[model samples]
Target chain A: MDKFLCGIDLGGTKINTVIITNKGEMVSSYTLPTLAHEGPEKVIQRMKETVYKVLEDAKLDVSDLEGIGVASPGPLDAKKGIVLNPPNLPGWIDITLAKILEDEFKIPVKLQNDANCAALAEYYFGAGNRTKNFVYITISTGIGGGAIIDGKLYDGANSNAAEFGHASINFDGEKCQCGSYGCFEMYASGTALANFAAKEIEKGRESVIKDIAKDGKITAKDVFEAYKMGDNLAKELIEREAFYLGVGIANIIMNYNPEVIALGGGVANGFDILYPIMIKTVEERCYKASFEGCKIVKAKLGQNSGAIGAAVLNIVFSKN
Target chain B: MDKFLCGIDLGGTKINTVIITNKGEMVSSYTLPTLAHEGPEKVIQRMKETVYKVLEDAKLDVSDLEGIGVASPGPLDAKKGIVLNPPNLPGWIDITLAKILEDEFKIPVKLQNDANCAALAEYYFGAGNRTKNFVYITISTGIGGGAIIDGKLYDGANSNAAEFGHASINFDGEKCQCGSYGCFEMYASGTALANFAAKEIEKGRESVIKDIAKDGKITAKDVFEAYKMGDNLAKELIEREAFYLGVGIANIIMNYNPEVIALGGGVANGFDILYPIMIKTVEERCYKASFEGCKIVKAKLGQNSGAIGAAVLNIVFSKN
Candidate 1:
């Protein structure tokens, strides 16, 4: 029997399930709206349905699968396979996701933080494949990170090693959701870009952004659009954001000196626009030797990276 | 026959040599003035004499040693065992101290940056002994750091990983020697503290520090002393320095989430005076979970940590 593994990427708005061969080639996939407003039980049922649908699409029996892996936003207890109350997903306090999935599927289940899954994906298939030591940073609504040292994930003493977003760029600057002031995320995340655009618009700056958002609800996409349209305010905001992001990256480079830094998530879709600026800023800030020859590249797996990486967790932890 | 190892710690003011048993127990140690003004050859000879004297003090012959390890300031090539233009040791550029020592001692020689040696010492015998992942930061005249991940030193791609001092805390802040602005070291190092004090004095701040150093030469020691005497200016300066240090530390804690953070060097000697303020600032800035149970302790090895750690290099590399 061809052994297969299942992976589920559970997000705030959706759940994606995929079944793959041992070699990591996906055989079938399924997706479902999370409807998290209905709560954990309903979400879990939807996840199960997606899993069953994926397996059915592959014409595979449950008995043919080796195990299941799940990737989700964290503060999660990965050892116990429980999801703690993540900021993005409310009312999810102390949910035993792994146990519930295991009980339903009668298969061993592994759970890891979503950012960690992305790092694993990068290590196994993305830019990180070229180096044993690297960091994967996903810049979306918020910045998230994972570290791969010696070709393995580095979970710190509390299983929360790479919280790169929370790293302070200014100790006495703006307040952050984590109750800190001047965290990198506060100044450089997609949310920060949106906030910057909104603030600029409110300051009476004339731009195409105001036309795109009649209700004054600015988004990162709108900022990028205005930037493309040659709005100076939008351009300046992105440049500033890239500068902060670059400083944060330089800090990471100095501290970890990873051979590669793989960038993922929605914001990285702007890599072409931001790469040169980020590179210039980072090069100017970090040690010359440490920055030399270090590869900074966009993540190749895109949205599927989490699911693909989650499936590979079985192989990774099994060895350990 | 029982094996022996030799370690040489090359410093700006002095050279320390120690003979140790294979088990890392120190058998004998000696120190000599670096006489850096006499140039590399003379200092190298003094280092050789100290090594031979220490071995003789231990009643051991040179042939009984397994290897020799030397720890020196970097901007050098460790793989080539060369000391390249270390700022403190003027006129010592591209000097192959390792090769010379190896030729003289007829044994294999290993070289490492002194900061890395301190980290290795901490990892093997000091505060980091129990933690597989930690960062060792030395806040002296300059800030330097080493990272120990999974029980091994992380040298990064160019053996320059863990340049913790270079990590930026503010993009437009003070300019550092490495040509960047707002580096952690620029705001947090002992030298930085003194610089802040000097700048304040120049600005006509009223303080007892003026009485202690009417000659216009200020040191971090003077600031600490003034703070002890309840000098408000000194207290404020120290508090501000501590705040920067704490923020830098919080940045590390959030980004790396190490199991422990070991503080070392002469500046760490004032840990008693600095600890509370630093901890308070970190508490205000860091994520709760990242710092919740993380241990921050003063390095236990004191001044000899570099030599001892260098001596242990054979064991660490061999075992790995």
Candidate 2:
């Protein structure tokens, strides 16, 4: 009888569950609405039911499972298995996720941060498979990252190593939501682009973005659309964002010297205008020796990366 | 017969060699003038002579040594064991130092960057001994650093991880020597402080630094001395330097989340005025979570760190 591994990616709005064999073959998978507004207990119950459904569809019993891995948003205490109060996931404070899952399924369980899970997945199956040291950066609503150094996850002193966006690119440029000054996310994240565009429109700069915005509010998608249509204001905003993004990438290269930097999340998903400029800026800024043979590429596993990476945790943890 | 290890630290002005037992007890040590003006071949010969002298003094034959390690300034290739053209050491491009020593003594020889060698020594015998994840920074004429992540030196994809000074603090602040804008070294290094003071004096700013300058050239020491005497110009200059240093430290914390940061090198040795302000700035700028339990302290290994760390390489390499 072949053993199976389970991985759960728990988010604010949804939960993704997958069961796979030790040989990297998928056995079963499913997703469910989190409905976190109903609170932690209900969410856990729904998650348990979804896991059971996945196991049943795969014709697997609970005892046949090797272990379970969970990837979730943090400020989490991975060692303690507690889900701390993440801004996006309300009422998840002090919840022992690994213990709850383990008790329900009678198997070992491990927990990891979502960005780290994506990096782990990429290291095993995506852009970083051929590289020993790499950084995975997600440039979505906010920038998040994970570093894989010397072929292992670099969980710092407290299991939180790569907070890339929080690193400052301009020490006095702007205030960040994290209560810091001039964070990389304030200049380069998807939300930063929208915010910049909104400010420009509000300042009465003439541009198509004013028309593209819905109800006097511009989204990152709307700004991207305006840039695609050759709006001057949008072009300047994106160019500035790409420039700062390049600075952040150069900083990462200088700091980690990773073999590859796999770019993911919405803003980095092959945004034609931003991608080339950002790459060029990184190459131009970082030390020549550090940049040599370092690759900056798009992430391959897409949305499935987090779930698959979380699931693979069982194999990594048990073996190491 | 007891086993022994050999370490060589090759610098522009001098060469240091030492022989030690497996237990890290120093058996013998010696230093020689490098006279690098005579070029790489002569420097290599001198290094060989120094190593033999140390061994002879210890009454050990070449066969008694486990391995040899050489630490030198880089842009070198650690894998190929070649010393590339480092700015400080002229005519050192592509010199295979390890192979030369290996051929001469018939022992395995390992090559490492000086900063990395110091980090390794500190990790095993100094400030970072208590923590698995730490960053070692040397701030003197310029800044350099290395990271130990997960109990091993993080050499990155190219054996050049943790170029901390090259990481930008303010992307548009100043043109740096590395062809980047606003690098940390440009703002916080000893050379940077001297250069900034020199420029300020040229701008006709009144200060005791102008009187302290030797032959109208302001040095960082002069600036520090003036600040100690309550010179307002020097005070403002030192404060700015400390603020930028703090920003750089905060950036390192956010990027690597190391358990501790050990600071060494000439400028950092006893810069009491800058230390408190720098630490405060780092605390003010970094996310509280990133700073939790993380320490910024003085490096304890002193000048022998490079040679000692290089010698210890045998133990680390053989075991891992």
Candidate 3:
């Protein structure tokens, strides 16, 4: 059938809506702040407004579309289409997100976690390119990942599978917020890089990281900026970040043995600088077969990946 | 479809052969010493002898069987039906074990790694019992595992996907034989447990572990024997073993998110003793969503698991 698909990427800070043809061509898209501090009801209302706006911009009515897909922060049940309490979205306790949207739009709605959506998006339209076994890892404030196994996204026993960040690299190193010890995120996430720099600075190690950070706490961005200016501390921290990232990647290689590992999120901005050392480190740690079979690349889809992935959910699931 | 199945479990020390019904009832079985030092050609000859013996014992000819399955130590190509150089099997380099068997028996034959075979056996006839997503972990001298995903055995990119032993738990800890730093096997294998005990004893924390071992090297068995005698050092070493095993298991849970994790091999013989501490540590390290969903249980098939798994390979893969 010739029709459009609607998608909503419901993030902590922004609500993005898009309308795309069945083949994934963009028709209309809209974005607005989530204003999460205002709570759930208003956020839900604004999400509806964006959907209507996208439909109007595309010059089509609801009858012209198949259904809507919502990608949200998880701990949510993709099967039940309920939003459990996600730390990112306050007051979303067991909310029937898909049902609400289905009732409001009078069409079917599907929901999935944001990370899985990005993975599905990359597999279909970006770096992954339909590889039967593909993994997408995002390394921003925290690390997150999704595995597309046998050409479909794996959601695990719960909707919370592929929590790669929580997998420990140091079992006795430090306690993590998730009640685990020495999580991969604790050693390799962008937040970890920044935190390491801050602690070293607090101990009075002199570096331009402080000057770039100004009066605020040192951020990974500040460290990256310092690395551009020949700051020794920044160089050291980034090198360690690359090494740590390689360790985490090797672990993923051991587990999934995927054909491609597409990197995304903020820290991946330094992909060029990180590639050489990161590849060397992964080579040292992983087996020859899995490592040789896998390609480590940067993700192709940009900021709109979530929207594209959500839109494709109905398409992919219908095919499944 | 009603024909019997034949299985051969080829190991470092012994070769076990079995004939079973398609539904998994054992008909006849036999075991013979492998004498691996006698090299590949002789080992292959002996393996054929045992298969004939088992068939004779069951009063059935090869023509009466559906197919034969060979389970061997890996680093081999299961798809190609070739046995590569496994450290445990001397002088075996790209030997076409399956082709040889197929020619000898004039029947279809399947070859899979030992760990994967055990996982298949468990999923079909034992503890796993048709669980869609299941993992089988065997912690012996070394740790090895196999995964069953979506009700099918997951043969990853190179048939080496579930090499969990090599996934590091300590990035800066010990260098493993696989050339990776701080592998889970280095910290938690039964060999590791005994090595940890031996090191502590060498530093002179007096215990009956030394007495139990006599002139022999301190082994995981010796440690358990001393634990039975209320030896403090043995107790401490076992406690550490439980903790490290838990850490490795938590990592598996993070990656696979399977519904069941069946523990097998020598270390699992002490499952009752290790259960309390191991469960506590896993609970402490893993996320509740997965932890609550998974059951860590002892394998049901005992030593015959290998033979049973190999026997069922044709039954399972034929359906796939």
**Among all candidates shown, the one with the greatest TM-score:** 3
lDDT, residue A66, model 3: 86
Q: What is the TM-score of chain B alone in each candidate?
A: 0.95, 0.93, 0.98
Residue A131 displacement in candidate 3 (angstroms): 1.0
- Candidate with maximal lDDT: 3
Fnat of every candidate, listed in order: 0.79, 0.82, 0.69
On the 0 to 100 scale, the lDDT of residue B118 in model 2 is 85
Q: lDDT (0-100) at residue A111 of candidate 2?
A: 90
Task: Estimate TM-scores for all models.
Answer: 0.96, 0.95, 0.97
What lDDT does each candidate get? 0.86, 0.86, 0.90
Clashing pairs in 2: none
**Runs of candidate 2 exceeding 4 Å displacement:** A213-216, B210-216
The better candidate by lDDT, 2 or 3, is 3
In model 3, which regions exceed 4 Å deviation?
Answer: none
What tens-digit string does per-residue lDDT give for candidate 2 at B1-320? 65798999997788998887776677999999999889998889999998889989999888899999998988888888999898888888899888988899999999988889889888888888748888999887888988888788888876789999899988887788788888999888899999999888889889999898889887788988899899998999999988888999999998888889998777776557788889888988776777875988888877887888889888788877
Q: Which DockQ-derived CAPRI band holds candidate 3?
A: medium
Model 1 ranges with Cα > 4 A deviation: none
Compose the digit string of candidate 3's lDDT tens values, residues A48-73. Answer: 99999999999999998888999898
Models sorted by TM-score, best on top: 3, 1, 2
> Which residue pairs come into collision in candidate 1?
none
| Cα deviation of A76, candidate 3, in Å | 1.4
